[model samples]
Target: MTGAALAVALGSTGLVAVGTPAAYAVTPSDEVAKLPIASFGAMVVDDAHERVYVTDGRRSSGESAVLVYNFQGQRVGSLPTDQPVSGMALSADGATLHVSQSHRMLTFDTATQTRSGASFVPYDVTCGRDVAVAGGKTWFTETPYNDPYCDRPDNIASLYGVSGTSHVNTGWQSQGRLKLAAGPGAPDRLVVGQAAAGADANPFLTTYDASGETLVRGPQRRFADAEGKGALDLKDIAQSADGKRIAVADGAYGTRLLDASDLSDAAAAYQPLPDGAKSTAVAFSGDGTYVARGAAASGSTPDLLIQPADPANGTTPLEFAFEGELDGLRVAPRGLGWSKDGTRLFAVTSNGNGGLWLHVIKPPAAQHDSRFTGALGTTPAKPVVGEPLGIRGRLELDGPAPAEPVKVTAVRKDADGTQEVAAAKVAADGTFTVLDVPDRLGEATYTLRFLGDVTHRPAEDVTVTVDVAKAPTAVELTAPAEATRTGGVEITGKLTGQGRALPSGIGLKVTRTDRFGTTGELTSASVAADGAFRVRDLPSKRGKTVYEVSYAGDALHSGSSARATVKITG
Candidate 1:
């Protein structure tokens, strides 16, 4: 196929359908700058000033440099370095750019593109491949490139942190070293894909905090390997906008998802692509709902896959392939000064003669535009029998409020079955409240749903658990040795469980069965604050007597000890 056809097939737009397929601009609005480097390890863009910063490492002479370029593709400034550069990072504010070169960490001012600081903190491993700047600290990974087959050293991988104020040339002590899976978190935490020393030897995920302290670790989970051959290699990691979810690039195995809150296990909800693609780069959109992955194979152009951040319904990713040669691939988003309004993307290409090529990517139009916000609240649970209970919540939204009318519905289900209870519309501030749950109608679980005029986006339903309260659990009935018309019985017990105190009221009913087989209903009393119940006014009948306590609608019978022979007193 002609180059233009190939470019179109590879998801590029810059093309002319002529005899030889001429190359034009794809997203002319989105541009890229070239650098003087044979091969690139890592690169970052400064979208605020329309400039790009790249690490230029000359393999033969072992010389390294940091080169800067404008969005219009002009060489602006270059900084010479003694050691080769490996990874790069930009501060949250985009004021500083941190570069991880051979055995040292260097910083440059974003405004001037000059060396601001330097440090010689020899990383645990040689190749300081990935770098991230966040929370006032710089983080990078040291992975050995020498022996890819050898059993990775227990200490072969580590994440180093340096304060922004620390000079780049100072020989600083490593904040801490940790065994991670593959890609660590850039600015703050390091998300590793390997196992620490333990019985759970499977390849898992963990995050090391900014202080180089291990914050959270994921349960043992397996990933695909390099060739899509064995299990996956957790090679690259990226976080969603809200930082609640993490996307792990498993070479050949595809990408995996983990909960950012605890870094515990793969989210129960996730979507994996078809196996066989070698995923190299992973990135997330600002809202944390979309994720993009870059894939390529030997002797082929690279492809891009876009999927939902946390996909539950098995959906496929939107795939786009690269048109020309794939070189230094990095994600430059907009909104953050380093990215163009956080929408455009740039891909660096390399020709045989050591020149740089650039490819610009424009995001597809947005699929949905509505937004949702709300505060969820639950009732004072664990109420005793016959107690009233419920849950309350509120919702908020932006833009002209929906006026066509909205409804809030509550659906409850239990060991018995499911039932719908309440429905209401959103108030002016886009607020809605629900109250007064029914009595324990043998139900254990309840869900709340909000239906609006527009079905494009429905408020997610919330779940509330309804369980039997244990307060006033057990009741004891004691009869006097001699039957007496004035003497009664005392019932005392503690209520305990996840939910015990029902707000409305706590009532109990007592019943007695005589030896004559006749059953008599006794006095009913409200349970005390301590879940204690006492009833008086009993019959002086002899033979044997049985006592039972009923709370709400469920009944409990006391042990046979509550039954005993009675004699009339003098």
Candidate 2:
């Protein structure tokens, strides 16, 4: 609720919905800064110096600067540039930052944020470029054209290795734009994926052994199936910390885990993303303990997911839904970066309207245990149809108090099928109340869930079943003591019911009886919104006459009737 804390509600359609109470922090995280840039090119985290470098790739000809922010997201300084900077990568030792601009490449000392050196690049293209550090050298991609043609399929994009004041053409080229990824886990290896620019329909993903003098290409891969249905739409790439595996963020597919050597599918793949979400960026933490998967999803769908790097670890992910102007709409392409310690995750998000934000998140170092403490209890021992029922339970969570209050989600299942109930806010004492109105009779089951948060693991679900009974309805009648045979006998009455409001325009059955005990059915009386109705009838038989009003119950209420005695005179 204070500082950079945000309250993000997780969508049910997602694989994991980590719901948090409103006005409460979604996680122990913060949106550190609203980046003052129209477009995002790249993000690089300098763990050694506790700084972050973000480039504004929107500018082509005008002078721009690489925006620098401290770990807390405060703008510390900027490294001015002659032209807009595009791609960036941090050196293996964290001493140098390799940045690529439209015309040339620049290096900066991570500790001082000062320009260390510059190198000449052949192409002065405005299509942007990608930079990476591998084999004790700097590597960058060159898209040889200006705007509008940057994404053309026939555009010549080449990979070049920075050598002191000049760049050596690696002689490797691809159509459209090229993306580069490298990590300390595989210092000698560089992974490349063809961007989904108007280039190759089935873009290729390959690796190169950069340890040698010449760039030796490694396993190459294409994703198109026999029917050409699954073409690679590369958005970002990441190699595991140990270099044994690689992860690709393909818009066409979800996140793809591949063997770093053969590019074959990894033995285990992550679960598919929430529906309607497309992969945009991914990164493994410097320590290889976690992987941050970024997506471009709308509404409540999570835009970012932080989970265990190893897919086998079935730990539920901590999800973040970025909505509104302040937080941006979704994670940007290649927007995820992390500190080497694996504690802080830096993500860049962009709204479709050209707004951007920088989020600095601190994932819990350890997840604590949580559990349902006692048997679930329900109020109004006997639940009735069309009435509110409250389910009460206690959740015991370990570790310190949550940054924000947690919530419990509920679902109701009956003969009609299952439906979700609104989430209940957990009180400070770990108590929560799930409220719902039962609409059907017979047995109804309610299941409650606590999906957990960044600091706690999920608690086992609890369920309670109750028998729902129809609501009781009654009719009251009032009549005059006597009436003439020729004159009509008038009666007035009211209908009353419990739980949900009774249906409007109700019609009650009416009957008339004389002193002889003979009874005859009469016209029905219509009830108004106020449940009041009037009846009029003539009594041919003299002496005593009786008028009765009755109501037959619907699916939600039980039937009831009332009678009034009246004297008749001829």
Candidate 3:
């Protein structure tokens, strides 16, 4: 009877309905720092120097500086850049941080936070630049125009490469701006995604082999279903430490996990964010232990989450719900960064004012394990179609008690295909019940899962199959032995049904067969609340006649029949 979680069902409508369990920290926020300006472009964490750098993309911030902080969020120092800074990246060796400015790519030493050198980009930067380091060089996106022409296909948004004090134009062109991503071991892996500012309806996302002399295009993709429902709204793209998987932060869709080889949807996807929360940024930690998802949202809904990188693992993420002015509202785009060891995470948040805050968090390194005990059982021994059914089971956790109760998610697969059940709450006693109504007769299977939390590891799935039977319904009849031809004969019957009440005012199908072996249709008898019905028929020929009553089954009931015979006198 004791449980800590709330019960909320995913309505039969298939809309997502997440229960708001109390939020508990996997680990408390280590530090919070106020940024020099609210304007943010991106963040990069330097594990080698034990520092983190954040860029201020405000072109009018006067003298913009790359704000620097220690791993603990203590303000270490700032490297003053002549112009506003935007996208940033660190070298494979982690010795230098590459930052993009209006017309130049600047380099700074992570060890001393000092500006080292700069290379001029070929074009006049207007839409700003996105920078990344791969194949032992720096790559960036360039847009030549300064006004509303940024989205023009003629504007010729291009990619440029920088190495050894030389700026080499890659000659790759697109209608709009491009976003770039490359990590420590992914030198050969360079990703460019389109952001057309509304011009390009179907923007392309392509990967390149930065390892070779000429950039070789790898897997390329542009998404739009047959009905054109899912379109890519690219915000950020991150590669796993091993460079096998790519996670795209899609505003139109939730976080998309894609295989880096072909850019296809991964086998399993992370559970959706609470409704109304759009993906703003996504990144994998350097060690590949966790993946962080940032979103812009309100209230108790999460604005940031850190979970396992393997979607198939289904671990509940360590959640962060950013509320009012005390700590910014939501995570800014490209606001997430992690230390190489996956021990420290940096999140940038905006307060809607001209203010920004940096948060430092440490996630649990190891998870407490969990398992579901006891065989699954239903309240009623046998279930009938169209009736509420409850499948009960118990979940046990190995570690200390959870900060809040956990929940178990389930899916029901029947003749109608698969449907998600409303999540069930795990009681303090580890007991929870999966509730659903079987819509079809035959066998249905329910699969229950526990995507573990910061406190626990994911449990193996348990399945239970159920047999559903049609509801029973019958027709009862009462008749007179004989009747005169002058008075029409009246036949009476009652209809009874089981499982949810049969609808009122139902008509039973009736037919009459004469002694001559000719059959004819008769007016149907309407059944009342009391299940009583009567119908009259006059025999054209004086002979024996048979009246047959039948009730065809509905969605949940089986059909039944009744018959009566009468002899007529002339």
Candidate 4:
């Protein structure tokens, strides 16, 4: 889709859009700072003070530190740490910033530019990624480095909590650990995703109550599957303001949306990018209307795709293509603070020198929409069979709301490469339902076309792919063997795999071969609750007849039953 089309689609959401830029402008004013060295770690923004914080691990000197800056990219001060600072977090008040380095957590008083009561207690294991602060405590992921096994033991991957009130020399105490327990809310508890387990790693998202002793494990969200194809090496996570949703950036899965209410089944409910974009950092807009995902790249020209909360209705995201190189390749998003009004977004990055890059996310001009916008707010670019893909969309009139009715059509191309199936006249609410698309051989693209009543403009189309069965299976046919000549034919069958029912709503095409040496026309049917189908009024020809079942897109066919001779002997 063109950038203009993407903007128009998203404009329906009442948001201002910007056009795509030919090239990013690099002004001397855009230069943030020059780092002391090349190493990079984490970057964050303090929205309250309009300042940014960036950390340099100082792997060479072992005296890592964080640098502070004003919104204009001027370096204000630098706070030094005893060990390498790998991950960082800012308190809600933005007065205290926490840094994790060499298995220790230190609180820095940003106002005083000094250590707050000597860093907090040190952790037992090295942290893998970013840290989050919530409910008066600091949370970090502990992935033990000693384990030789590919998957870290349950104890190796834990969410260690340190009291914000604790002093560094006082020794931070462990709050609680996440584990499997039985109870009404037991399944909701979060666990740590297995580290280095490839696809079999299961990560838990655990949270604790006030006292911190009684552990409340929310749910175990698998980071990777057994095959490692969808493995999610989650690097960063940020929750929406209302805490209703959490956006996680997995190395392999891009960004995953989790329902905070039910953490147990949230992984299964996640929506990932079809293009398999790798996300290095994630931050939710203040109001929770949009999410900004930072792509991990060393080059200055990185494409950041802004995904919307809803994808089914063709809401494409806004993309900001950067012009300069990122100093820190492994840099985590630091100072992720939104404006009080939620209008502006700020991010910090390492420029590979001793300098830091201050990234300001401003709303693009009203007229220009970037290329990344085309990917947002739409259904997954690719929809898997049996999934109840959502579609939330709005119609845009040239001037005012249309005076007459609008017709929305969903056209599904046959997987067989020959036929086209269509559904017309969607409801007034701009909604349509398509079920049981047959498991075709290759990729099938579905287009949604909207026709305005009085407007003479051409119809608008949104293209999305549909993936067919991953394994080969025969199409089952079920119907009455002997039927009355006057009645229609009811065909029914189950699509099974390894003795289990396939995912629901697989579409299939049924055809009949008559003894006359000519092939009959094809008919389509969606899988039902029992995987059964009934097609009435199948026109019968003379002599014996044979019925065959096949998928819509592919040429594969199911085993045909013996011909049932239809003798019309008068």
Candidate 5:
């Protein structure tokens, strides 16, 4: 199921937890900082030093700098660059940071925050490049040519491995911009994907065994279906903590989870993103327990989701909707990174106005148990079809109360099929009422669920079966006590039903019994929109006459009849 949306409130240095009631006061645990750069390029986290490095990717030959921040979201320092900063990666030991530049690859000492070394690259690239620390060496990709031509499909791009004073061209080349992803879990493995900006009808993604002296390509994949639909629109990619799975954020397809070994679809995949959201960034926690998926969404739609790394886990994701001036509205592409302990997530966002923001979030350390403790009770005792019924139940949550009340979702299963009922909000006391109007008769079962939140585990589902009976209907007749034989007897009646409104155009059955004890059928009377009907008849024999009006009920109503006597005189 899609996770619930939580709107985060940003302060100068803190972020208040969402998903709680507005009236509840909350302690700010997360951090948010306004980025100084106008454009976002990449974000790298050094868990050892608790520092985050973010770069400005906009092409500029004049001057650029990598903004640095601590785990607390405070600006710690900056690394000045003669040229624009592009892709960046942190060394496995967290001792060095590799930064990509137009004419060189610069390395920074994480401890001293100073340039450790600089290696010359073969190409002076005006277009930004991608850097990754893989195969026991530093590798980067170059899109030959300058700014405008960077995204051109005809541009040639190549991968190079960095050595002592220069870089080594791996001789592997492709058209347009190429992306690279490598992590501590898969240090010797390099995952690469092509950008759709290259005008490739179908983009390709492949893996390389970087452990050897030379780059060996393995398991290549092209994502176009047979009908030429569903081509890959890659945004960001990441490898699981164990390197057993790879997750790709495709704007056209949401998040695609695949087996890392062969790039095949994983047995299980994460749920579809919220509507109107486009995938932008993805990252796996260093500890392999969580994966953060980011998207470009507007309004209250979530732009970031933190959930279990294992797709099969049913735990609900912790969602964050970033929509504030201090916090960017959407996540930037390739803007997510996590600390080694899987405790903090670093994300970069752009507000579409050239403004960028950085957020450091800490997930809850523990999840408490929640359960439905007692049997559900329904209002009105006896449930009738077409009538509103409230299912009352109590939920026991073991943890602290949520800022906002939690909701309980329910579904009704009947002969016709299953139907979803509106969610019921749980009060502070852990009591809730699920209201639904049963449309079908006979046995109907209501199943209520409480999908867990970030701090609470899911509660065991509880169900209640009910026997639904049809609504009762009645016919009321009004007739004169006496009528001359020469004058035709006229009778007025009304038809009404409990629960749902009675249908219009109801034809009531009418019969007349004369003094001779013989009965004859009269013309049926059509009911008006107000449930009123009229019946008129002329008796051939003048004497005491009985008039009976009856209605045959429909599926949701029970039948009923009424009678009236009129004396006829000559």
Candidate 6:
């Protein structure tokens, strides 16, 4: 049918017509920063200086300097070191940055960005070291050579007292490489855990009393099922501000929240991660209000999640996925760090190419609720199968005006099953229309949703039911089975339509063709209130005569035709 004819045919049917984009849409995540780093080693956020320090560990790179970036992600300066840097730690007052080199420990003044002091006389340090400040003193770790054993019982990894002489051990020793974390403002509380190594079957984690000069080990842990199924594959650990809770990034599990006092499971835990993403890092904001969890995932999978620290809040975490060229594929191990105010999070991402990128992301931490207002409305009041449909409703957001137009997604459920409808952008006045072309012919239920952005909470779902129907028009004919060649011969028929009643007294053009070599156009029949019509004709001759009747379709009803055969006996 021509476009003009199809438009006229559907004019009275009251089906909605619309124009929309054909591409599918995803949640928008702005690219805030893309630092070109040759390699990724460590990332630490300095709240006091409003700067972030990153380094290229002893990998394939030969440059021996710590790259510094302000909270906004601009390259500020570099802290040149004697050797490649490993673990980085900040003092309790945030004045000094303690960096661990191969065989020595160095401290940098945050105010001057210059080296303050250094220490040596350490055992030949081949394996990189991890450093931290605890118990009002600085401490460092030492693992012999570059080999981390999994089965050895020897005291290969030892803890040292760095406050005065880091060259000597504080008398705490373990079998594998150890990682450290301290509660901000709670130097007395220290957390140490074993990095999963080649030999240790059950890695250990314990808290320590750092208020004293001596190391006092506290509640210890090594998670394993009865059959030793779920052993701890520790990547990173973080201490809460209140010194009451701890969060661990476990490769086996996602994020595990533990009680600070006993190192047991906390009353609540973090939500499960999106599929195919494993826990690579975890950190609690300095204020203890939010937590950032990092995962090594690709494509549209979430690589970072920032959500409420308290699992009880149950707020959906803001998600970030890095894809496309110039974008990293996944989050590196222990790659997420947060600023003091939770305003910014610094992440290190590495792509398939040997390059790495430093990303400064500001996740949505504040949210306002949203709801639909008034009654739901739609275009073309009654819906029809294979026709465009428009469901319109107004959304009232509790937050300030958004930076960009808000989008509303819709899903339809019917006999064939559920399908996702193309998302519609809301207008500045908060009115939005969801358009769809329903493929099925049964009851179609539309469920509209607002996934909410960085500043808004998801709106409550709105549902509307639509009755879809098929287009109308049918024909039936009646004639004597055997008609004589007389003037009494008459053919009658009835026309019917579905959706709306046909226009009364509408004219239906008719045609008649005899089985013989004779054919002629019959007079147009006027339809009656009962939708019945008739045609009368006289047979010129006789053998068999065929009478065919047809009605041209209209705006609301399709065209139909019927034929009757009579044995015209002479």
By TM-score, the best candidate is 5
TM-score of 3: 0.70
How many backbone clashes can be found in candidate 3?
A: 4
Per-residue lDDT of 1-570 in model 6, one digit per residue for the tens?
000000000010111212121222232333334555565657788898898998775532244888888887789889998677777888888899988787778889999999998877365344566777887787778776544442244546878867443466777877767888886746787788887644546788898888875878888998877787778888888887677888899988889999888989998777667678889888888877788888887666667777778876534456666664555777777788888887777878767566677777676557888888878887788776566789999999886877667777788989988787888888999999999977666688998877666567667778998887655577788888777777546878898876556778777766655676587777777778998888777776776677777767666456777878777776
Please give the ranking of all candidate structures by TM-score, highest first, separated by commas: 5, 2, 6, 3, 4, 1
Q: What TM-score quantifies how close candidate 5 is to the native fold? A: 0.88
Please state the error at residue 146 of candidate 1 in Å: 9.3
What are the per-residue Cα lDDT tens digits for candidate 5 across 172-216?
988768999998788899999988535557888999999989999
lDDT of 6 at 430: 95
The runs of at least 3 residues in candidate 1 whose Cα sits more than 4 Å from the true structure, single-residue gaps closed, are 1-36, 57-62, 71-75, 123-126, 143-155, 163-188, 193-202, 211-230, 264-276, 287-289, 298-302, 307-318, 323-340, 349-356, 365-570
Question: Candidate 3's residue-wise lDDT over 329-361, tens digit each?
Answer: 888888899999998889898867777888887
Task: Please give the lDDT score at residue 238 for candidate 2.
Answer: 91
TM-score of 4: 0.50
lDDT of each: 0.50, 0.84, 0.79, 0.48, 0.84, 0.73
Q: Model 4 segments beyond 4 Å from truth?
A: 1-37, 58-61, 123-130, 141-158, 163-195, 198-214, 223-229, 264-276, 297-302, 310-315, 323-340, 348-356, 364-570
lDDT of model 5 at residue 380? Answer: 78
What order do candidates take by lDDT, descending? Answer: 2, 5, 3, 6, 1, 4
Q: Candidate 4 local accuracy as lDDT?
A: 0.48
Residues 211-322, candidate 1: write the lDDT tens digits.
Answer: 4332333333454345433453554667766566776766646666677766545645343432344666676654454566755433333345555556552222344434
Weakest 10 consecutive residues of candidate 3 by summed lDDT: 1-10
Give candidate 3's root-mean-square deviation (CA, Å): 8.6
